[model samples]
Target chain A: MSEPTRGPKGRVEIKSEECKGCGTCVELCPQDVLLLGNDLNRMGYRAVTYKGDGCTGCGICFYACPEPGALSVYKIKDKALA
Target chain B: MARDTFTKAECLYDRYVRKTKVEPDQVSTHYCPGCGHGNVHKFVAETIDEMGLQDRTIFISPVGCSVFGYYYFHLSNVQAAHGRAPAVATALKRAHPNSIVISYQGDGDLAGIGGNEMLHAANRGEPVTMIFINNAIYGMTGGQMAPTTLLGMKTATTPAGRTARNEGGPIRVVELLSKLDGPVYLERVALTDAKQIYRARAAVRKAIQNQVENRGFSLVEILAPCPTGWKMDPVDARHWIEETMMQVFPLGVTCDRTKEIAPSEAKPVPFVHTDLRALLDIEDESEGFAPNRTHSEGVERGVRLKVAGFGGQGILLLGQGLAECGMGDGYEVSWLPSYGPEMRGGTAHCHVRISERPIGSPLVAESDVLIAMNRPSLERFLPDLVPGGTVLYDSSLIPDGVARSDVRAVAIPATQIANELGSPRTANMVMAGAFARATELFTVDHLKASLPRFVKAKATLAVNETAIDRGAAHMEKLLETVMT
Candidate 1:
């Protein structure tokens, strides 16, 4: 599995430094596109990471994540990547 | 190439620079992991941005885990005292009628300590939005049982588990507030799952929208999770809110009258000094009595006078009369009365300050002049007299006179003079006359002119006037004798 910054339709960016590894976004993500990474962030909690593909960019994960800047979801304007 | 559509909310500060402690990341909130406050804060920020209320919003942060709400939202913020968010919000909304005020409070703050404030603010139908986070426990103080704590919920204060008999059932705030006629919208939403959180965001938007439209008080009570306070994992806390807390606090709108009710038309009247005078029925300076020249001169450095006597001896009335006359003479004046419960016989004293400048304190701890109507009055307050201060005692009531030599003591038979004037009640006026002449603060004519303002009975006015003249004459004769 290669880590791609953006999928065909959308992108999800997780600021690892701000994540507390609560798994709220991972549990709430509809596309199963987020997971808690094995490496710990600066604050010593496992940080969330986006899967390489299949991100619908529903933005539910953004709302689910407690930290304000930890997660941001974006819908791609170009459809050709799909 | 992909272009971005959805992004972080604009209402939230880019970096929480206000979070003074820099150890934790400044880009993140101070709330614990999966804490409900963070989600609610995000929803509020998003709503503010959507509604374009960033410039007009004033957030009142309560004393709770979200006390640092000011640090996150890039809006005007005020941190209210514990449980006083509603009161603070009420004042803010009234003072700035054009602004949208939002009071953010927790269960312990809104329901427990500030319950009365919340209820009354709702009852008054103040045009403000309230976001209540009911975590069922005191999250900031460490899992103490709150008023919204569900039955059988074990907390630090409820180690035996909350019993209905001991702790009573949880308070349904939305239901209680729904019964009031003031609130235009009331809803309870939870932050348990994606669906519920979406509903909570909608409720938050609706509540604030109601305020923007001037629909009056709107409250959205969100059943939030406290993972650290509950001693549970973040996911389990969410499950507990869904399975347990939801059973006690059912989700949905408890009351909604947003359609039927009209937008608030009553605007707060801005405070004006002249308007206050008109409201109080006080005439303008041009139409009012002119200032007495002598009194203004005597009040250049201010005068602190203590009057003490038996209650029925008119100790308070004398002080009031002096204060009123001083006010009419264009001096800043204050009268503070202290008395026991008994109406007639109790010991009574009053402090009077007449000043050219504004009086700082009405308490005359040390007096420039002391008027003692009785022996105990003289003995009790004599020590507080400054050196070279004047003492005017009713010689008919206390024959011993003032014993101190350092202060000027003037003996006036005020009660006897009042009896000779045919009314014993006129003794206060006689003393007032002596005070005026002895201090040369004002003339007898000034007292007579102001007498009708305070002295109610029309029949006794003439006798009171005569009593004032006699007292002034007595003081004048004493001064003449001293000069000889």
Candidate 2:
């Protein structure tokens, strides 16, 4: 209800539940922005998410992630995934 | 399209993340050991990495030893059906014209069943880069005789040498496809040694760059080796590509439309118009359309014919022109160029299998009908005619020249009829007429309708109609006594 219009750069959302924790995307990430998530899911595989000030709005992670829609990278010149 | 974040700078293969110089962690290649496909994949990936197009490029991988290419390309890729990579590439290139679309396929994938897709895509000049691997056999299917199999090369089905009487010869794909006017750049390269591998990689980059610049259809057919399928060691495989494959599928550029493509004066890569239905359309008449053609049984529903004659005698057109007629008559039909180089002023032939059932095995060991435009073809193929099959030839060819006795042989004055029609080129149409009249292979009305599909000029179409009718009229009496 509080959300306003999102314009310009596209929104990228990470579907946390679908993550397979293959770590391929993590290893592939040239930015060193994604570290394995500290929170463990019921499946026991460590999930991956953006760390502090590390993500630099790179889309290569989107393609490198084989899991469909699990890891989406949004466009924000200022809001970094880190 | 919404803009997305990230580029190759974030990928694992980027120098910083690679840890070592080796990128794309060495996973066990899904391809068999020593297959050139692995090396080819490496070249493509390395080229894309060097070009910095990894995020923007899309790949279409065909079913073969290379089907698992998505694992290695480090880009968005969709695996395509066997022999269908060209078609898929055509579609993706049109829909996403800015993306660098590429198709990687084996010889059997590009030159056999997928041949139509390959030709149509190239003829239309799609801005897609194609990496054709000419390995001479259907590697994924366990070494079957592919359209690219060289004459005298043995395979699972052709354990004996592919002879003119049966398997014909290996198809020269680059040379054959180069004739299409729309292709802007065509090059046949190979990977026999270190220098050749370097050249092959450069060829890959060039083809990709051509697509990126919107020049036109660009293809680099790599004379790749299949050591497992060829029953050779890796070293010997390289030797074969140098010795045998190069003899037939010579390396270097065959046709390059790049002379006029100076990027300083060029437009962005143009989008290709590929009609899906047109690619798969079956010509047919409204009246004979069977609702349950799937299970219908009339006249046992089709015949397979092989026609052989010299290149200038209208040999190939005869089969294609008739196949068009049969297709118009609501019959399922496929016409394939006989496996071989198109002999210069020498023998040329085609295979036509018209059936309600789907066609299989373009190879013809026993044809329902054989039409020979000369004495040599008759002598060569007469022995393989099916029992009770019809063998028609030019009356000009005499009995001492023939080689078999089990089947029926009818000598029609095909050349005389064609010459009398005022066009020696009509000899091919004359044979088509004889075939149609003899077997009701398809109706003449339908055959005429199919004629214009092959010709863009209406005047030529009108002339061919006359020639075909004349051939049919000339052979009527003889056909009545010898055929159904």
- Best-performing candidate as measured by TM-score: 1
Instruction: Report the lDDT tens digits of candidate 1 across residue range A1-82.
Output: 1334543667788889888988888888888888999998878899998877778777788888888878888886676664
| Alpha-carbon DockQ of candidate 2 | 0.08
Estimate, for each residue in B254-283, the C-alpha lDDT of model 2 and write its tens digit. Answer: 788776876532234453344443464533
Question: What is the C-alpha lDDT profile of model 1 across B261-301, one tens digit per residue?
Answer: 77665477667888778885664665435554343344265
Query: lDDT of each prediction vs. the true structure?
Result: 0.87, 0.71
The list of candidate 2 runs beyond 4 A from truth reads: A1-82, B1-26, B264-484
Off by over 4 Å in 1: A1-7, B1-6, B18-25, B264-266, B270-279, B283-285, B291-299, B309-313, B337-349, B361-366, B372-384, B391-427, B455-474
lDDT of 2 at A28: 51
How badly does each model clash, as a count of residue pairs?
Answer: 0, 17
Model 1, residue A48: displacement in angstroms?
A: 2.5
Candidate 1 docking class:
medium
Best by DockQ, which number?
A: 1
